[model samples]
Target chain A: MDKALLSTRNLHRSFGGVHAVKDVSFHVPTGAIKAVIGPNGAGKTTLFNLIAGTLTPHQGQVIFRGQPITGHKPHAVAALGIARTFQTTKLFPHMTVLENVMMGRHTRTRSGFLAGMFNAPWTWREQRQTEAKARAILEELGLTAHTNETACNLPFGRQRLVEFARALATEPSLLLLDEPAAGLNIYETQQLSQLILKIRDTGITCLVVEHDMSLVMNISDEVVVLDQGHKIAEGPPAAIQRNPEVIRVYLGDEHA
Target chain B: MRLRIYYPVLATAVLIVLLHLALAYADATYYMTQITMSAYYALVVIGLCLLMGYAGQASLGHAGFFAIGGYTAAVLTTYNLRPYADAPFVSLCRALGLTMQWKDLYGTDILSFTPWAAFGSALLLTGLIALVIGASVIRLKGHYLAMATLGFGLIVYRIALGTPVLGRADGISNVPPFHLLGSLQVNGRAPFRIQNYYLAWVVVLIAMVLALNLVHSRVGRALRSIHENEEAAHSLGVNTYRYKLAVFVLSAIFAAMGGALLTHYSGSIGPAEATVMKSVRYVAIVAVGGMANLWGAMVMGILLNFLSLRGVFGSFDDTVFGAILIMMMIFAPQGLLRVPRLRALGSLVSRRSHA
Candidate 1:
C-alpha cells in the first residue's frame, strides 16, 4: 500500500474542562482529496489548527510524509511542506494581491537580507522569477486581472481564491484548507471543487475541513464526519452519505 | 529612472553640497556650528523614523543605545584616566599582554580612528546590544513592548547619570573630533564647522539610504505582513520574531552610529544627551513626518532641525514639537508629505488653463 501523505495517530486536545478533540486518528493517502466535515463547535477547525501547528495537541503524533511534526511552530511546519488556509481569509490586506502571494514564496527564497537591501543582481533576478510565478498562480485562479489591487479591495469570493493561491504558492506537499467554501456562492464552490481536483492532480494531498456537504461529497475521495469533537463516521463519500450517524447528524432521526 | 523621484533627490543633493561649500567660505563660525548640530540631530531622527515608522516597532530605548555609543567613545578616549577610567580587569589584561584592548589593537587614540572605523564599531556594538534586548523583549506584544523599552531607556539614563566612571551627570567633554585620513585637519582649522557639518550630513544621507533600502526590500515586505497580521505572516512561513529582532537590532545600530557621529562633531558627550526626553523627541520627529514615507522623515528632520537652530520657536521647541505631533496624530496622521498631492493638482490645473 502507498504510504499516507499525512496521518494523525490518536490525536487528543483539551482546554480546561472541555475536551476539544479526543482519540482521533486518520490517514490521508497521497494525491487524494479528504474532507473532515462537522457541525459548529465540533473541533474540525481545531483539528486543522492542530495539524497546521497553530495549536499543540496534548497527546498525538502528526506524521507528514512519514515524519513526525506534532509541536513545531507554524512557520516551521509550513516550511516542512504542509500549508493551510485560515477559516477567515487572512490576506495581508494592505499589500497588493501579487505582493500577498509573493510573501508565500518567502521560505523558498535564497537571497539574504543584505542582498535584498542592496538590490543585488541575484536578488532582483530571484524577485522577477517569484513575481512571474505569482502571476502564473494568479492567472490559474482567474485573479491575474486583480494582481495589482489591494487584497482588501477584492470581492470576498476573490479574496477566498487569493488565499488559496497564496497557500498553493508555498509549494506544499499537503494542503489543509479550513472552510474553503464557507462564504462562496454556488458557482464559486463549483470552481473551488474543480481547483481542489486540479490540485490533487498535481500530486498534492488535500485535507479539507468544510461545512458544505454538496461540495465535500462531490470532491472528497473520502469523508470523515466529526460531531462534538469525535469522529462519527469515516468512509468513501457514497458510504458517508448513506451512514445512519451522518444522516442523524445532518437530518434529525424523524427525517432520516 | 522615475524622474518624479530622481529629479527632487538630485536637486536636494546639489543644494546640500552647495550649502556646505558656501558655509565653508562664509566665515561665520556660530551659524556653521548650528548647521553641524542640526545635521547630527537629523541623523538621529532618520534612524528613529526607520525604527518607528517603517518597521512599526515602538522603541523608546533608542536613546539608551545612543548614550551607550557616546560612552563607548568617551571611555575609549579617556582610557586608564581617573574618574573616566577603564575597568581594572580590562586595564590589567591590557598591561599583562593577555589580550590586546580595542585601543591598543587599533594603535591610535579613540579620536584618531578613521571615520569608517568609528562608524563600523559603533554599529557593531549597538547591533549586539539591540540583538540581546530584542530577543528578550520583542516577544511582548504592543504597548507592553513599548513600556518595556521605555523602562530600558530610563535604566540606561540612570546608569549614565549615577555612574561616576561614565562621567556621572556632568558627562565627558573634549571628545576628540573625527579625523579624516592622517593629515587632514577637519577640526580646529579653517572652516572646521563647515567640514563637520558636511561630514554629519553625509552620515545622515547614508543612514537615509540604508533605511530606504531596508523598507523596500523583502524584509520590509515581511515586516509589513507581520504588522498587518502576525498569524498570517507566520502561516505564510515568515519567522516574525526573527524579522522583528533583526529590524530592532538594525534600527539600534543606525541610532548608535548617529550618536557616535554627533559625539565626535560636538566634541562632547553627556548623560542628558541620552535622556528619556531625548528618546521621546526622536519619536516626535518621526510622528511629525509621515511614518509611511522615509522622505517625510528626511524632510521633517532637516526642517525641524533648521527651524530650531534659527530659534524659530525659542525655548518653545519642545512645546512646538509636542503640539505638532499631537496635531498630526489627530488631523493629519500622514503629515506634510500628503500635501504634495494638492500641489500636483494645482500644477495640473495651471497646465490645463494655460493650454
Candidate 2:
C-alpha cells in the first residue's frame, strides 16, 4: 500500500458534551481523491476543521507529509503545503479575483516588509511571477474573463471556482475541500466533480467532505461513511454502496 | 510609472507653491505658526488613515505613541549634562569642539541637540515601544481592539503626566529647532517658521509617497485581506498577526515622527497632548476623510486643524466629528469617501463610460 499523504489517529472533538467527532480515524492516500460522506450533523465538517487546524482535537493526532501537525495554526498548516477551501466561499471581498488568488502565492514567495514597501526589483520579479502563475490558474479554471472583477461580485457557482483556483494557487500537496458543490446546480456539480478529478490527476491528494452522493461516488477513489460522529464504514465507492451499515446510517436514512 | 511620478511631483510642487505664497504674505506671525502646526497634525492623520483605513484596525493608543515620541525628543534635546557632567563623553565633546548647545530657562540649564538627532531618537524609541505593545494588542478585533489601544493610550498619558523627569503636566519645553539638512534652521534664537513649515510639509510629502508605495504593493493586498476576512487570509498562508503588528508599528512610527517634529517646532511639550481625546480626534480625522483615502484624510486633517486653531470649532470639533462618524457609518459605512454602494457603482459606471 502507498503511504498516506494525510493521516488522522483516533480523533475526538466535543463541544459542551456534544461530541462532534468521536474516535474518527482516516487516511488519504497520496494523489488519490477521497471523500467523507455522511448525514447532516455527522461531524464531517468538524473533522475537516480539526485537520485544517481550525480546532484542536481533544484526543488525536493529525499527521501530514509524515509530520505530526496537531494544534498547528491555520497559516502554519498552509505553509506546510496543506491548503483548504471553506464550507462557504472565503475569498477576500473588495479584492479582484486575480488579487485573491495572488494572495495564495504568499507562502510560496518570499518578500519582507521593507522590500515590499520599497518595491525592490526582486519583489517586483516575484510579484510578476506570482501574477503570471495566478493568471494561468485562473485561466485553467475558466475564470480568466473575471480576473479583474471583485471576488464577491461573481455569481455563487463562479465564486466557488474562484476559491478552488485560489486554493490551487497555494501549490498544496493536500487539498481539503468542504462541499465544493453545495450550492451548485446539477450542471455545475458535474463540472466541479470533473474539476476535482482533474485536480487529483495533477498529483494532489484531495479530501472532500460532501453530501452529494452522485458527485462523491462519481469522482472519489475511496469513500468514508460517517453518522452521528461515528465512522460506520469505509471502502471503495462500490463497496461503500453495497455496505448495509452505510446504507442504514446514511443513504437509507431519509428525512420525513 | 509616469502617472505615479506625475501625481507626487505635482503634489509636492503644489504644496511648495502654497508655502511660497504663505511665506510671501506672512511675517512669521503666530497665525502663520498655527498653519504650520496644522501641517504636523496632517502627518498624524496620515498615519491614522493607514491604520484605520487600510488595515481595518482601530488604535486608541495612537496618541500614546505620539507622546512617547515627544518625550523622547524632549529628553534628547533638553537634557543637558555639561556643567555637572563627570562623564568622559562630556570632556570629549568640549575637546572635539562638538559641545552641545545649551539654554537656561527657569534657572535650570538645558542641553540642546540638533533637530535631526532628536527626531531620529524619538522615532527609534517610539518604534521600539510600539512594536512590543502592538504584538499583543493587535490580536484583538473591533471594539475589543479599540478598548485595548485606549487602555494603552491612557496608561502612557498618565505616566507622562505623573513622571517628574518628563516635566509632568508641563512637559519638557525649550526643545531645540532642527536645521533641515544642517542648513535651513527651524525655531531657535533666529527661528524660521517658514523653514519649519516647508520642513513639515516635506515630511508629510515623503510620508504620503511611502504610503502610496505601500498601498500599491503585495503587503498592501495582504493588509486589506486581513481587514476583509482575517481567517481567510490566514488560511491563504498570510501571517495575519504579523501583518497587523507591522502596520500598527509603522503607523505608530508615523504618529511618533509627527509628534517629535511638532514638539520641536512648537518649542514646548505637554502631557495634555497625549490625552485620549486627542487620539480619538486622530481617528475622527481619518474617519471623516474616509479611512481608505490617504489624500482625503490629509485634506480633512489640515482643514479641521485650521478650524480648531481659529477658535471657530474648538469645543465643537469632537461633537461634529462624533456626529459625522455616526452619519457616515449609517450612510456610507465603508467610509465617508465612498457614497452608498449603489451610487458608488453607478458613479463608477458613469465615470468609466466618460473615460
Candidate 3:
C-alpha cells in the first residue's frame, strides 16, 4: 500500500463561537491528485492553512511524511518540503517576475545574510543556478516573454501562472493550491488543468481547493466534499459525483 | 564582489570624492564640514532604509538608539567612575604586582579606555538592546509599531534629561577622538575638518555597499518578500519574524556606529541628541530618498541634512521635514526617483477632474 504523504487526524478549530473546522481527518497518498471542494464558508481554506502551518489546529495532528507537524510555523512546514499558494496573488510588486520566482527559491538555497552581504563565491554560484532554474520554469510555463516584467504588471491569468512557477521553485513533494481557478477564463482554466496534470506526472502530489466543479471533476483522482465545516463525502470522482450528500451540499436539499 | 555589478557604488564614491575636492579647492571648508556632518545622519537613514523601507518594520525611536550610542561613547571616553591605582583595592593589586585596565592615579580616576574601544562597546550594546526591543515588538504592524518605537524614544529622552550621571540636560563634553595605530588620531579639527570628512564618507561608502548587497541577495529577497506580504513570505520559508529582528538589530548597530562617530566629531554629546523629533527626521530623510532604495537614502539624507545645517530653513528644520513627509506620502510615495511618475499621476487625476 502507498504511504500517505500528508495526513490530518481529528483536526478541530473554532474562531470565536463558530467552529471553522470540526473533527476533519483525511490522508493524501503519495503521488495523488486530491481535490477538496466546497461551496462558500466550508472551511476548505482553513484546512489548507492548518496543513500548511499558517494556522495551528485547535485539536489534532498534521503529519507530513510520517512526521508530526501540528503546531509548526509556516516556514518550518515549507522547509520540510510542503509548498502552497494564496487565493489572492501575492507577488512582490517591485521585483521582476524572474526575481519573484527566484525569491521562492530562497528556501532551498544556502546563501545566508552574511554570504549575501559579502557576495561569497559560493553564493554567486548558487544564485546563478537559481536564475537558471527560474528561467527554465518560466520557459516551460510560456512566461519567458514576461520574465523581466514587474509581477504586479502581469495580467490576472499570467499572475496565477507565475505563482504556480514560484511555488514549484520550492521543489515540494506535495503542493497545496487554494482557489487556483477562481478567476480564470475557459482557455486559461484548460491550460491550468493541463498544468496540474503535468505537475502530477512529475510525481508531485497536489491537494487543491477549488470552486470550479468541472475542473475539479475532470482532474481530481480522489474527491473530498466539504459543507459547513464537515466532510460530506470522500471517494473517487465518479463516486463523489453520485453521492447525495455532496449533491445536496452543492445544490438545494430539494434538488438532491 | 563583481566590480561590474557594483558600478553604481563605485561611481557614487568617485563622485563624492570629486565633489569633496571641488569644495576644498573653492575654499568652502565650512560647507564641506556641513556636508560631512550630514553624512552621519545619512548613516542613520540608511539603516532606517533597511528596517522601515525593506523589512517594513517601522521604528520612530531610532534617535533613542542614536542617543544610547553617543552617550556610551561619551561616558566611556570622558568619565571614570572607578577609583584608580592609588586607591585601596588598586594599591593592593599593585602591591601584589598585579594590574588592572582601570587605573586609579593617586585618588583621581580618569577614563583610560581608547575611543575605538568605546566605539566597539557602543555597537555591541546597541545590538543587544535592539535584539530585545525588536523581539518584543516586531509583530506589531504599521502604526502600532511606530507608536511603540515613539514611546521608547520619548522614554530615552526623558531618562537622558533626568539622569545626572549622563550629564543631565547638558550632556558630556570633550569626547576624545579615536586613535589609529596607537599614535595617529582622527578628529573633527576645525578650519580643515579633513579627517572627519573622510572618515564619515568612508563609513557611508561601506554602508552603501553592504546595504545594496543585502537588498539584492537572497536575504535581501526575503526582506522584500516580507515587505510586500508578510503572510506570503512566511509561507515561503522566509522566517519573517527572525528576518525582521535581524534587520532591526543590524539597523540599530548602523545607527549607533554613526552616532558614536558624530559624538567624536562634535567632541560633545547632549540630551538633545535623544529627542523624539530627531528620529522622525530620519524617517523623513529616507522617505524623501525613496522607500527601500539605499542610494536614494544616501543622497537625500546628505542633501536634506546639509540644507538644514546651513541654516537654509533657519530653526524650522522640523517643519520642513514634516512638510516633506506629508508631501512624499501624497505626491511621491514611491520616492524622489519616481517624481516623474507622480507628475503623470497628477496629470491623470487633473484630467479626470476637468472632465
* TM-score for chain B considered on its own, for each of the candidates: 0.80, 0.87, 0.87
The TM-score of predicted model 2 comes to 0.92
lDDT of 3 by residue, B223-307 (tens): 9889888898898898999999999989999899889988888788899889988998899888887777777788888999899
TM-score of chain A of 2: 0.96
Number of the top TM-score candidate: 3
lDDT of 1 by residue, A168-223 (tens): 99899999999999888899899999999999999899999999999999999999
lDDT of each: 0.77, 0.82, 0.84
lDDT of 1 by residue, B1-355 (tens): 1123334456667888887667648855566666666666777677677667655677878889888876776555444433322668555644654332234333543313344444566678878888888899998887798899999899889989998878887887665656656644335334575566666667667666666555656677788788778899999888888888887877777677767767766666899877877777777778767665666677777778778778998999778877777776676654444455643643442221100
- The deviation in Å at residue B246 for candidate 3 is 0.5
Q: Which lDDT tens digits does candidate 2 get at residues B167-252? A: 99888887777656657665633357666666767777778777866776778878888888898898888888888898898999
Q: Which digits, one per residue and each the tens of the lDDT, describe model 2 over residues A42-142?
A: 99999999999989999989999788999998899999999999888898877889988898898898887788667677777787888899999999998
Candidate 3 backbone overlaps, count = 2
DockQ scores for all predicted structures: 0.42, 0.56, 0.57
